[model samples]
Target: MPSYAYRCRGCGDTFELSRPMAEASAPATCPQGHEDTVKLLTTFGTVSRGGSGAPVAPPAASGGGCCGGGCCG
Candidate 1:
């Protein structure tokens, strides 16, 4: 699951939601019965698991390849 930011075009209200990636672009409306709402591009306040907190993988170490067998070929 991921969290996203959304804004209401009718009432100018902004909010966040934890939804599936497929539903991120679903039709959403304001609680005030305004159907003219649109999603907004906003930065997240903090990095959480549902947001930018997604983990990043690290590169593997090769222990310094081709060391000449400790003195010669």
Candidate 2:
């Protein structure tokens, strides 16, 4: 299951719902029972840690191309 965020235009409320990924784009009703709701664009991230329970920084990207490698000349 995945969680989705939605905003209600009628009351300007924001809410979240947990549902299957297949229905992620389905219409949602706000807690105030407003039908004029639109799904919000949300971002999800994961932290890789070594059992320390501390948040880990995401992996670094591999440089590429001339400019990326500072070889543009």
Candidate 3:
């Protein structure tokens, strides 16, 4: 199930709901009992299985095909 964010116009409250994608467009009622609510556009984050916390990938090993093998020289 994916979580959808919504904002209430009557109470000015923001909330989230988890439901099936089929019912994503369904009407949402805020906790303040406000029927006037609109779904907010949310961005999904990417998942990285990398162990390092760095933003970029690790550098390649010194021993490689071209330069390491001295082919370019």
Clash count of each predicted structure: 0, 0, 0
Between candidates 1 and 2, the one scoring higher on lDDT is 2
TM-score, prediction 2: 0.64
Model 3 ranges with Cα > 4 A deviation: 51-73
Candidate lDDT values, in order? 0.75, 0.86, 0.90
RMSD, every candidate, angstroms = 9.2, 3.8, 7.4
Ranking by TM-score: 3, 2, 1
lDDT of 2 by residue, 1-73 (tens): 8889999999999999999988887889899999999998998877656678776679886676756766754
lDDT of 1 at 66: 75
When summed lDDT is taken over every stretch of 10 residues in candidate 3, the lowest stretch is 45-54
Model 1 per-residue lDDT at 61: 57
What digit string (tens of lDDT, one per residue) describes model 3 on residues 1-73? 9999999999899999999999999999999899999999999867588756557758978865767866765
Candidate 1 Cα outliers beyond 4 Å, as residue runs: 44-73
Q: TM-score, each model?
A: 0.51, 0.64, 0.66
Top of the candidates by lDDT: 3
Q: How far in Å is the alpha carbon of 1 misplaced in model 1?
A: 1.7
- Per residue, candidate 1 scores C-alpha lDDT tens digits across 1-73 of 8877777888898877788989989887777777787787866565556656667679865445476344443
Decoy 1 TM-score against native: 0.51
